[model samples]
Structure formats: C-alpha cells, structure tokens
Target chain A: MQMTKIKHHLTDALLMGYAAGTLPEAFNLVVATHISMCDTCRAALAEFEAVGGEVMLDAEPVDMAEDALADAMARIMNAPQTSLPKAKPAGGVFPAPLRDYVNGDLDRVKWRKIGGGVSQMVLKTEGGASVRLLRIPAGTAVPDHGHRGTELTLVLQGAFVDETDRFGAGDIEVANEDLNHTPVAEQGADCICLAATDAPLRFNALLPRIAQRFIGI
Target chain B: MLNEMHTLAKADAVTVMPVYKRTGNAGIRATGANRVMAEATTKRMAWVTQVAAVRDAKDKAAFAELFAYFAPRVKSFLMKSGASPDLAEECAQEVMVTLWNKAHLFDPAKASVSTWIFTIARNRRIDLLRKQKRPEPEDLPWGPEAEPEQADAMGLQQETEQLGQALAALPAEQRKLIERAYFGELSHSEIAAETGLPLGTIKSRIRLALERLRHTMK
Candidate 1:
C-alpha cells in the first residue's frame, strides 16, 4: 500500500490497550486498520507491545507440568511448519484488516441506507463498542452531531472537512463527547470511512434524531 | 471514562520526547548512560542468536534451552492474565510450538524474542479465552531479505532491556498499575480511570526504538 501523510495517529491509551489485548474487538478493528495504513502508528504500536513484552518477562515464573516439554515437542512434530507468506500488494483502498471484516474489499460491503445520500454497514463485533463502514456521497454533509462517548473516524477513501480540520485517506479523527461538529465530504470524491463509536451519537438535527433510532448508529 | 481519556489526551500532548540518536562508537563510551546501554546490548543479544539457531538448524538442544527458560515464564504470564492453571499450561505449550514453527519469521531489528513471544501469547489469550477475532496490521510489503544488521538488532535489544530496567525501577505503586494493565487485569475503561499512571515516563525509550526501526526500514 502506498503511504499517505498521516497527520493524526492513535493515542497512547488506545495503543497501550491494544498492546495489552484489552481493547474491545470493534476498537481493535479500527486500530488494526489504521495501523495498516499508517506506519507512524505501526511503529508506536510496536513500542507499546514492547512494554507488554517486558511485563511478561518480569512476571513470576510458574513451573510447567513434568511432561509439558515432551508434550510440546510431540505437538511441534505434528504441527505444520508454517512460515508467513510475504505481504501481498493491497487489492484495494481498504487495508487487510478492514477487508477481513468486509469479506473482501469496498464492493463487498453490504450497506444500508440511513438516509440523506449516506449508507453504512455495521460489522459484527463484541463488547460495548460498534464499528461500521460509512459511505458519504461527494459534497454531502453529515448532520451536525456530538458524541455521547468516544468516536473514532478513519478516512478510507476521499476526504471530509469537519469543524476541526480536513481528514483525507488514512487520517483518523478521534472525537469524544466534548466536540460537536458537522462533517461534509470534500467535493471531488465520495468519502468512505471506518468509524467506531463506544456509545450512540446524539444528532443535532431533530429529523436525523428520529432516523438515529431506526438507523442504529 | 471521557474524563479519564481527556486526561490521557493532555498527558500525551506534553510527553513527546526527542528520539535517541546514536553515532559511531557512541555506545562504546564508559560514561554512565552509554555504559548501561552497551551492557544491555551485550546481555540481550543472546536470545536473538538462540532463536536463529532454532530457525536455521532446528537445533533441539537450543530449543530445549529456550523452552526451559521461557515456557515457565509464559505460563506465569498466562496465569496472571486469569487463565486457569490447566488452561494456561495448555496454552503455554501451544505458544512454544508456535514459536518453533514461526522461528523463521522472527525479526530481531523490529522486536526482541520476548516481545515477539508476548504478541503470540497475547493473541492466543484473546483467541482461547475471549474467542475474539484479533485484527492485525498488514505485514510490510517486503520481508526481511536477510538477517538484519547486528547493530540495529542490538540497538533494539538494548532499548528493550533498558525499558525493562526502567519498569523495575519505577515506584512500587506506579509499577503495579503498569503490571496490572499488562496482566489483563485492567480494561481500557479501568486503565483510563487510573489518573496517576506513569506511561509517559517510558514513551521516550519506545520512541527512540521506533526511530531506529523507521530508519532501518528506510
């Protein structure tokens, strides 16, 4: 995959949580997808994971069963000797992680219209957070909204301009309850994003508020 | 949770540190920091060699040595993460088998052996306990073409060692918090609740290692 200039990156807490294997699956999807596209975050994740390595190293040792090594050796004999295939060139705009969720690339996503020229497909995930793929037609504006909790929006195709700034491909915008803003797709291309929200969003406009009930966003 | 993560945002803002840059023979100096760094480099490179022996020769003796040292530790790690003794034992064995199988993929420049094992074990925990799908980043387009430069590997190993030392040296309370987080005792929300965590203290060392890895990638 070609590298895009990624100005926004994951936070330390999210990185640490991912490294520690504590993030909810939806959030892990977002983190993995973002890291796939952004080398900077990938390097940061390695750092966080190193901390986990040290933690494990420093744990008090526990003795294994008397026959454990022999058992493992036998198992190793039976186990297929697998080596990682070298990474393939990406097939589309969605990275490997996102593609796994979609079952393929962009075309495979099963989107449901939420109204106003926007469509989304929520992926199955466990725990409290929810992740989805959103497609916004070019020049369309998503209704103004404030988050009830943390919302992570990662641009996958094209760009969007919010009150905060412009987010292009590979840029992730981390929004919490404190910020309320309207985001509009840039005029040139339809914007596709991978968004994960820990809680339901509260729409600023009344009509979409009713739509939110049916939309399950 | 928002309040705590907001604090995280603030903490992140103030903690960025300069990457540790090295020049020729800089690690050889006898002065305090350099001496410690060089010593760490020496002490930590052995694991890399042991992993290579397993990969290149399928050396059973080397595998035995590694198992003897790391298996018990891996068990301990799993147990701490709330695995039952039996489950932890079973999974720890699986983790070792994975290590031997994937030995060829080990990249010393990117991660120390322990770090690599930690990732494998971590994935196993998520799979075995949570039964969750763990999404991983795409691998770099190119695999390590050959054994990486010894210096780059050594530098990473040294940084990892220093990071361990720093964790050991942290005050008991802060260290316990970090340990709890790593041990899977703390959820992300719970980790956010901890206002006094010293995560910033170790960020610089990690950043330094990242810079080296990035430089090597280039």
Candidate 2:
C-alpha cells in the first residue's frame, strides 16, 4: 500500500478538544478529516476518548428529571431518520466526509474568483469559525500571511509547498499567529484545499488585503 | 508471554471504582453496601457487552439498561460542566435518543461503552448550546473512525483495567487538569484562565499527563 505522507498532524490540544467535543465545527471537520486519513492521530484520539469516558464514569451523579427516559423514548420514535446520509459521489479528489459538506461532486462546488487565479467557496456551518474550499491554479501563490486564530488546511488534490513544508493530497497544515508563509501550489495540477479558519488571515500585501475584505475571507 | 500473564493476574487484583461511586442509601452504607456495590461494578463492566448486544441484535433490553445507567450520569456530567440543571436534563435526554438512533455505529474496538456515550453526551450538549445561536450543520461525521479491525477481547479488557490504574496513579494536579478538560468541558485556555495558570503550563501539564497515561497503560 502506498501511504500518503502527512508530515503536519494536528496538535494534541486540538485532538483532545475534538475528542471532548469542545472544538468548533470547522476545527472538528479538520480533525475528523485528518483522522479519516491518519492512523496515528486516530489512535491518539482513541486514548483521549478513553480518558473522556473514565472521567464520566467517575463523576458524581446528579439526579435526572423523572421523565427523562420517557422523553427520550418519545424523541427516538420521532427522530429524524437514523439512516446515514448518502454522500453523493465526489470522485477521488474529495473524500466522502468532505463530500457530505459540499453536498455534491467537485463540479457542484460554487466557487467565486477571489482574484490572483484563486477562487473560494465558503461552506456555511454553525459556530464562529470560517470554513471554505479553495482552488488555486497551478503555480499560483496565496498572499504571504499570518493568522489571528488557528487555521487548518487539508490538501484534497494536487500539492502546495509553503515556508514550513510541502503538502500533497491527504496532508494537513495547521497554522497559527506565530507562523507566516506564502503557500504556492506546485505546477502540473490545480491545488484544491478545504481550509477552516476561526479568524481572518493576516496578509502582507495591500492588494490581497483589500481583496480579503471584499472576499470575506 | 509469562510476563504479560503475570501483569494481567496482578491487574485482576485491583477493584478501581470503590473510590468513585456515588453514595447510595446512607442508612445502608455500612451494611449490604458491598453487595450493592459489587452488583453495580458487575453491571458497569458488562455495559460494553450490552452495548455490543444493542449493536448486533437491536436488543431493546440492552439499550434500556444503558439508558437507566447512563442518563443520570450524563445529566450529572453536563451540570458539572456549567450547564443549568434543566439544560443538562434536556441534553441528557437528547443524548439517549441519539444513542438509540445510532447504536449500529458503535464499535467496541473504537471505545468502551462509557467512552462512546460520553462523547455523544458531550457533542449533544455542545450542539444544544450552539443551536441557540444558529442552525446545526448537517454534514458532520458520526465521529472519529478508529481502525476497522476487531480488537482482541483479552487485550481490550487489560487496556481498560490498566487505564484505570494509570489514571489512579496520576498526581492530583495533573488529574485535575485532565478532568477539567474532559469532564468539566473546559478548553485549555479556559482552564488556564479559570485556574490563573499560564496557557503554556496548562498545555504542557495536559500533554505530560497524557504521555504518562499512554506510557503507563501501554
């Protein structure tokens, strides 16, 4: 089997938060997507989950409302269909997990050009974080930028190399305020990524900065 | 092989939950309590087997047993994590419903029944909190997909027992941080700010504690 090289795995803090269900949806998506591809992180997550269960078992009990079980039964009887949503095929580029969000294949994504041969389509989700799919034509470079909050980018197709490392399909890059980089997609194919950011990016140049405001990035 | 057997034998000597069980029937706390406690322990340990029954056979009896045991525990958990009593009750109810709806997705290798139910409770509570402000997303995965391989029963049993031992051996300070992160539902920064510790210290303490846990349990 040819293993996908994923050099930049998520930090322990993020994974713990994800396991405990404390992270926002965007962060959870990144964590879940990365976990689908990385066995190492999946194991770490299992440990954290084990810890979560132990704490729960050890917690002092509080009396529940008398009708809680009956209420639960009522809800279950009327629960929204329990069947797993059938994720429309997204071919090979987008995994089933990501396809569920976009709701269709690559052709169905609603991309808007954000200038500089790059386009983005924001996926609406609950919570404050911003999540979007980005498309960069071959050899195109995003603005050199820092972060105001955590940003996680997972490469879906093609490849992008930044100041820190090169990421191909299935690899993830986690960036925060301490880091700054210009991510340029390698030539030969267009780079597509699912990027989730809790806050706006910090761009160095004036043109991109103005575009960022308009693009709602 | 002999060494592993020896470790397993030594592990069987420990009964870890005596320190943690909530007080029941204060008048009978001294007498007959041990029997009640033993029965409870047996019931708790067998929860995983019951969960598997729910998964494989759609056993209503098994699910009822789970609901009776876990519903109050989940409510207590949510309340301790700063939710109101009523909100906790509602979240717990929702969590149980999800359990019934999604029982087929539960895998013993991925987590113990307690762990699986705990994650569901935690997520359901968070979803309730978020639903107040915005609509919930329809696309989130069922959860982190652990490997598909069915784990060895003896190995999994030993891991759970050793996990309790590892948790018991942890220093109180490190244990508190872990409890706050997992059960108290506080993020690292929130825990740090609430505890007046530096963010880095909070992160490192949790990291160190998890490292010790993994080392010891393994």
Candidate 3:
C-alpha cells in the first residue's frame, strides 16, 4: 500500500445518510470506497450504523402475519445457502466497491479523454449524482470549476493539491457550491481519483464548459 | 493454548442467555420495570447465541426463536420507513432468511444483534424500494479474528444497551428526529439540518473493535 497520509474524510451527515441507506448510489460508492481504505471513517460509519440500530429497536413492534415465521422458514430451507466469499485482496488502486463498478482493478477502467491530457471513465449509477474515475497526468491541473450541489473526490492513488489543501491516497475532499478551485496532480505520479458529483460543475473556462455537454461531465 | 482456553470460557459465558426462560409478557413492564430492563438486555444477548446456533448447527428452533422476535420488529421498521404492509412483510421474511444464511458474518464483539439486523433490513429496503445498489465496504478475510475476547463482546452489548436507554431517554422531539433519520424519512440535507445528537462514548468502543478487526486481518 502506498502510505500517503489521508487528510480529508467523509462528513457526518453523509455517513448518516449511508447508514440510513438514503444516499444516492453514486455517493454511496464514494463513501464505501473511502471507508474501505480509511479505518477512521470505517469506525465512524459503524457508529452511525449503531445509531440506526437503536432507532430500529425503539420502533413500535407491529404484528406480522400469523404464518410469517413458517413462511420464512420454508423460504430459508428452499433458498440456496449463501456464504459470502471473502473479497480477494485488491492489489490495485480501486477498492472492492469501485472494482465492482469498474469490473476489475484500475487497469480495467475504459478511459475516455475529455481534454488537457485528462481522461475519465464514468461509472453508471442510479440517482441524480454521478461518479467517475479521473486520471490526471503528472503535475497536470484539472480545469477550474465550481460545484452547484456537492462533489466528493476521493484519492485512490497519488495525490492532488487544490487551493484548500493537499489530498493524498485515502483522503476524500468534500466540495460544495462554496468552493471553486483547480486541483493539480503532484509531479511524481499521475493522480487517480474516484469523484462523485450531485450536480454539474460550472467550468471557469468557456471551452471546457462547452465541452462538458459533449462529455456529459 | 491459554488464549484458546480463555476464548472458550468467554464464549460459554455469552451463551448463558439461552438458559433463561422467556417471560413473553410484554405488558409486565408496567410493574417491575427494572426487571423488564434486565430481561430485555438478556434477550438481546440471547440473540447472539441463537445466531451462532444457526451458523454452527443449522438449528431450526434457534432460527425460529430469532424470527419470532426480530421479524415483527423488522417489519415494523420497514412499515414505518414507508414500505407497504405487504411489502414489509415479504421483505421482513427475506431479511430473516438472510439472517439465517449470513449468521456467520455476525460479530458480537463489533455489533449487537439489533444492529446487524437493522443493516440487513436497511439494505433490503434500498434494493427493493429505491432499486439502487448498495456498495458495501470490502470484507476483511480474517474477520474479527484475533479470537475476539468474550469480554469485548459483553462490553459491546452492554454499551449497545446503554445506547438504547440513552435514545429512549431523549426528549420526544429529538428522539422522533433520530427515528425519522434512520427510517429514511430524512434526506441528507434534512439530517444535516438537525443538530446535537447525544452519541457519546460508544463510538470509541466501536472504533476499538474496528482496530482489533484490522489488526487480526494483518
């Protein structure tokens, strides 16, 4: 594992939404990928899940159908027993959740060049938000843009520096409508990020803004 | 060898819940409330044993006991979360069946039985109602495997009980907000709108558990 310190993390509200299973699939993908690498967020997620559990426990117990147990038992007997196969260690940058979307590791990603030596592969996810893998060449800067809603960018490999701070592997940058900054990949390695945006980005450059529609970014 | 023996002793201690007879009298809480609290905690602990039984022995009676207790609660949760009664019923059954199948995945040192069941039901709701795939975190192959100490499991269960009591003691409005959040009634923005949920202390214990699991994985 490349040992770059993770500075940014998932927000409490986002973690709670994930625990409640209410986040958009795109956001969930980003959160899950981050938690896979960051144990701090993993533990935080467990705490939110514990809160969900208590809420469920406090719910008034409604009566189920009289034959519910018997029916469930029958189903259990008929259903094929499923043992969750332990996930194989991902030797690549993408974690299990992102790997599932990419169909494999980083090498499997089918990249599409948008512009400026920057390439991306959009993963299909339901809901209003969109997630994609962005690969920026060494020392390259992604076009300056501001989010309309929320955008989550998780560093999978290498590091990126924006006006706010440096985000390295396992770090997640949560950008809302307030921030407009250009993220530049560090000089050593090409930065690979799994980013999810709830709304379209308003690019500062007119050319990229025009290209955004063609690229569906 | 000593560590193995210690683990065995702790496992034995956790299984003590099965020996206690179910009071089955939900209405008895009006009189001896303290005793009811103890019984509820014991009943919660018993679920750990029942899950283990279903996992190791495929014990039908144990599965039935778990179904009887949790199925109604799961259905009620789903119904409150906006699933129709019939859909809740169907999903509740599926959730129970999933419980039986995935019993081995339940780690008492990490989560209480209710927590485990809540996650299953929540995932099912997302898949069925929202029709969205839930991307789960990758599993650690070794699991909670430093041969989880029985003390850790007991402490976690106790903390979970305390958490439940704390939640129950919250002001009605605050409690209702929390319930709504977990029931999927609140959007992310709405959840952010609310503030000051009193989730204290238990977070450290869960974090410790995760650390232990991570350690064992290595």
Best by TM-score: 3
Scored by lDDT, model 3 comes in at 0.82
Pitting candidate 1 against candidate 2, the one with the higher TM-score is 1
What residue runs in model 1 are displaced by over 4 Å at the alpha carbon?
Answer: A82-90, B1-40, B189-218
* Candidate 3 per-residue lDDT over residues A1-217, each given as its tens digit: 3334567888888999999999999999999999888877887787788888888877888888877777777787788756666657647777888889999998888999999999999999998899999999989999999999889999998899999999999999999889999999999999999999988998999989999999888
Ranked by TM-score, top first:
3, 1, 2
Question: Which has the higher lDDT value, candidate number 1 or candidate number 2?
Answer: 1
Q: Candidates sorted by lDDT, descending order? A: 3, 1, 2
Query: Across residues B1-218, which tens digit of lDDT does each residue of candidate 3 receive?
Result: 33332343344333533532344552224346567566666667678878877887777667767776788889999999899999999999999989988887888878899999999999999999999999998765544255355566666777777778878888888888878888888877688634455564567886676566556556
Decide which is better by DockQ, 1 or 2. Answer: 1
Per-residue alpha-carbon lDDT of candidate 2 for residues A110-217, written as tens digits (9 for 90 to 100): 999999989999987777787899999999999899999888998878999999889998788888889999999999899999899988999999998998889988
Q: What CAPRI grade goes to candidate 2?
A: acceptable
> Candidate 2's residue-wise lDDT over B110-138, tens digit each?
45677778878877766676552222222
Q: True interface contacts reproduced by each model, as a fraction?
A: 0.68, 0.45, 0.75
Interface RMSD of each: 8.6, 9.6, 6.4
The CAPRI category of model 1 is: acceptable
